[model samples]
Target: MYSSLRSLADDTFCLRLQRAARVWRKVSDEELSNLNLSEATTTPLWLINKLGEGLRQRTLAEHMGLEGQSLVRLLDQLESAGLVVRRDDPSDRRAKALYLTDAGRKLAEQAELVVRKIRARLLDGVPAEHLAIVDGVFDKIITAAID
Candidate 1:
């Protein structure tokens, strides 16, 4: 039966977390596919929506933890899809600013709804107190990893 829970140890938490992340990503990918989007495009789209027009490509790349060329490739795809645009930065003639097209803005709204649904499903039955603790733990882990 499901007797392995009896033998679960504290040290296995990280392994469990990794498995959970993988599963979540799989589910998210599947859900996003219905909208003709993938996980790769979700964050950047959301960021563009949140940061508004005139967001620099370099700034978005930094926030996304992606290299310049990598971000450019993703942006290229978005631009080709007509979901985003790259305008010349007025203050910096050499740099490009990121902006969502009208279509991009509509997709961003849909993305937000999808994200809300996913979060609700994922957090279902999880107590708020427990989630707060988990959030704090994640912050600590991220800070430790960065340092």
Candidate 2:
């Protein structure tokens, strides 16, 4: 009986975490849309900018937890918008290196600001100690999942 109760509690905790993730993504997407970006594009752009111009698509996709084809589509759109460029990798002729264009860099900066504001709003009432605990819990969760 005790084991069953523990299992139920664990399940409920997982469900709550999933629900929170969904809500956060939905809200983020809506906010990003106003800046002519989607949840998909904003993170990639920001990461590319931070990672520097010669970052590989595969690396970016891995960091973003996306499949290759999905990342390709996002890159296609970004390229068409003149926000990103896929340059031929000097070391590997077949591979393309990802780089943000001038426009992309500008947008990335703005995206950073937007993200900061959004994070502030989302964490407004949360106490620092609570946030630290949550952060630690997430770190453990991610580590466990990865292993």
Candidate 3:
């Protein structure tokens, strides 16, 4: 059985994590809320910034680990938000390519800063040497679940 102190310690850690997440989200949400960008667009926006240079939507979807209608829905929302625009692939009329708009690019830049600030705040109290251990444990858990 867990002792009261042990339980209290676990609860305190969980509370801190929850509060950190909330703070991180607040920074993002406050920064982006007026821009009409949804939180879901964050991943797709990053993907576009990384690989949308000349890739097709289908490839982007696969890269993002999304499939079929779900990807379509995300793409639709992004398109509707004017953050991303889809155009027919000149190489293949059947395929479409994606690109970020000027506004999207600008917003993404601001979002990046917000994300960095959140990271800074979260890691402020953490020692650099312990980061590797934290990363290692997270990677182990993720790999174990995926594998």
Candidate 4:
């Protein structure tokens, strides 16, 4: 099936990206489900871990492209699960800084492991140069889209 309105090239990249994301999420979820975590849940942990100290809710929401309320809800869930904590920022009186508990940090590391394994599995037969080319192409696509 194809769109009558646009060329195949117009939709093919988007379709492939969407499908790839779905496949990655599905496999990641399967692995994380045992720990009651999905790709969605793991994302915040990953971001927090990456950002290290002084990560704020406002900044995190911006990174995730989520509204403040949505991020707060997700954070609430994580907090309740004893994975994360928010404290008054030392530098900024109004901002709340996010810190991962030992459990949260551990989960973030586990999530990274799961992602790396999945990536290796999916690209096992692909050449390193080919992967690099694909990465470069996607980088261009992202830059163009953002601009």
The lDDT leader among the candidates is: 2
TM-score of each: 0.83, 0.88, 0.65, 0.83
User: Residue 83 in model 2: shift from native, Å?
Assistant: 0.8
Q: Which sequence of candidate numbers ranks them by TM-score, best first?
A: 2, 4, 1, 3
Q: Rank order by lDDT, top first?
A: 2, 4, 1, 3
Tens digits of per-residue lDDT for model 1 on 1-147?
345774565447878989988987787788888888877787789999998888999999878878899999889889999999999999999999999999999998898788789889999999999999999998898778668
Who is ahead in lDDT, 2 or 4?
Answer: 2
Task: List model 4 lDDT by residue over 1-147, tens digit each.
Answer: 775647787788789989998998899899888778888888899999999956999999988878899999999999999999999999898999999999999988988888788789888999999999989988897678668
Per-candidate alpha-carbon RMSD to the true structure: 4.2, 2.1, 4.2, 2.7
Per-residue lDDT of 122 in model 4: 84
As a whole number from 0 to 100, the lDDT of residue 35 in candidate 4 is 73
Ten-residue region with minimum lDDT total, candidate 3: 31-40
Per-residue lDDT for 39-82 in model 2, tens only?
77898999999988899989998888788999999999999999
Distance (Å) between predicted and true CA of 68, model 1? 2.7
lDDT of each: 0.87, 0.90, 0.76, 0.89
Best by TM-score: 2
| Least well predicted 10-residue stretch by lDDT in candidate 2 | 1-10
Superposition-based RMSD of candidate 4 using all C-alpha atoms, in angstroms: 2.7
Which portions of model 3 show Cα errors greater than 4 Å? 1-27, 89-95
Candidate 4 positional error at 57, Å: 1.8
Task: Give me the displacement of residue 76 in model 1, in angstroms.
Answer: 1.4
